[model samples]
Target: MEKLRVSDACIGCGLCVAQNEKYFEFNDEGFSKVKQEDVEENDKEELLNIVESCPAQAITIEEEK
Candidate 1:
């Protein structure tokens, strides 16, 4: 499983949560956060799509060892 990370650059645009609520949510500070980091292989494509859709480019997928 890979780890999904949201950087501090997030502008709280809510695109991530709007696209996939299962994997993302807003924190108290209103920044988009990765609710779950252990991504399954089947969901990688959708996750990548969300990453690309981020207007602030705050999302990233970290390769697992």
Candidate 2:
């Protein structure tokens, strides 16, 4: 399975959150965060696009072992 992650490098630009509220949100410090790690099959493509559009390059997709 693949998991979504928001790294510490996030700049709190709100791009990901704005693109998709289902999996992305703001943290206490105002940085971007992944609301859930598991990515649904139907949402993968949209999430991938959001990841690529992230200016901070903080969002990523990782393979789980």
lDDT of each: 0.91, 0.91
Off by over 4 Å in 1: none
Name the 10 consecutive residues with the lowest summed lDDT in model 1.
Answer: 31-40
TM-scores of all models?
Answer: 0.92, 0.94
lDDT of 2 by residue, 1-65 (tens): 79999999998999899988899989899998889889999999999999899998888999986
Query: Per-residue lDDT for 16-64 in model 1, tens only?
Result: 9999888899999998898988888899999999889988899999988
Candidate 2 Cα RMSD after full superposition onto the native fold (Å)? 0.7
Q: lDDT at 31 for candidate 2?
A: 94
TM-score for model 1?
A: 0.92
